[model samples]
Target: MGREQEELWDAETAREYDTPGTGMFAPEVLGPTVERLAALADGGAALEFAIGTGRVAVPLARRGVPVTGIDLSRPMIDRLRAKADGATIPVVVGDMATATAPGTFRLVYLVFNTIANLLTQDAQVACFRNAARHLTPGGRFVIELWVPELRKLPPGRQAVVCRVETGYIGLDTYDTLHQHVVSHHFTFGAGRDARLFRTPHRYIWPAELDLMARLAGFALESRHADWNGTEFTAESPSHVSVYRLPHDG
Candidate 1:
């Protein structure tokens, strides 16, 4: 997260973060995801990594689950606190990669595409290590991230679309020979209101993610295409990976 980007993601903006597209994150997804996690936890407290705006935490709490959230953005947590149900959550303002909270949990959750913010293998892997430190033996860490870079065009060519309301439409062109991926984020609001945010990310494959989990002392336990326990496959569109720590975790 860049300094400028951080400012944009500050409290005021975060308060309306999900207002633009609230339907994208369905209770359908949240419901099943928490149900599976609850079963795995057998009714224990769960820790949410990068629990932005308490989207998942608030609902899970409503379901009678105990959850603690950690986030790097005070603005995000502040917005979360403004919610009627959000105040029930105990949120710590700190980096998810190294922040420590009060106690060990049976479940740790990192939802949405937040992992992309790490932007590096080492940083991403460090997130796993941090989760391990907070989990009890046989505790589970759940993660949800996009499948991979999607093809804007069938061919290797990249497509550029004009900014529209809601958000920008664009793609970062990657040069495989250079081993880098450029992120092109287009922001579209009202008329003639458009902005673009671009950054680079080191994309990782499933096998690489599994390897990182192993390095962090976690073993891959289950993989799902969605929160509903759909089979993970090439066409699944997203991933839900569950990793477990030993009894000594």
Candidate 2:
């Protein structure tokens, strides 16, 4: 795990963290995702780890699912609280791996690949254990992340432009290493401000995640490639894995 990168998540970045995805259409991209998470949670209480800017929490709450959130960034939570009726949702500033609220939850969710920000195997495993501890009997822990690094290897490493707008082109670089892969994002704009966002993510196969869940005392309940219920396969780009707690002793 990298220490310097972890510290980069302080106030400054948290303030502008929503720049890339904070437009009016942000809810369009996030609302459906929250809906899927809401169903997995069984329409009860839901907890979100790293609920940045209430992007997922607010809409989930609008769906009648009482949502709570925990984040390491105070400014992010502040932005969330500043929204209309955002204060209605309870939020705590703490680390997801070690923080537990007063009560158990029917659904615990971590989305938008936030788990990778932990940057350590132990922290990742601790997140699993913490999620397990927060769930009620037969509760579910749902996560949305990308697939293994193996798919974006060799020939697939070629730089691909994802989004282009107003003379700006977004380029991505993929580096496949011994175990994990790193993505370098370079946003170029003609006569405009150019920026770079370097994000290193840990990739895990379905089998590996199943083992991790087993170790955390949860069992794999469902695995899908996307929020639309697409089948999970080797070629799938993303994953939505659900792990459930035992119903009885």
- Cα displacement (angstroms), candidate 1, residue 154, comes to 7.0
- Global CA lDDT computed for model 2: 0.75
The residue pairs found clashing in candidate 2 are none
Q: Name the lDDT of candidate 1.
A: 0.75
Error of 1 at 168 (Å): 6.0
TM-score of each: 0.83, 0.84
lDDT of 2 by residue, 176-246 (tens): 44234455555565655777766666656667778878889999989988777889987887798999999
Residue 141, model 2: lDDT of 89
lDDT scores for all predictions?
0.75, 0.75
Our tally of clashes for model 2 stands at 0
> Where in model 2 is the C-alpha error above 4 Å?
1-6, 19-28, 84-87, 155-178
Clashes of each: 2, 0
Model 1 stretches with alpha carbons more than 4 Å out = 1-5, 84-87, 150-192, 195-202
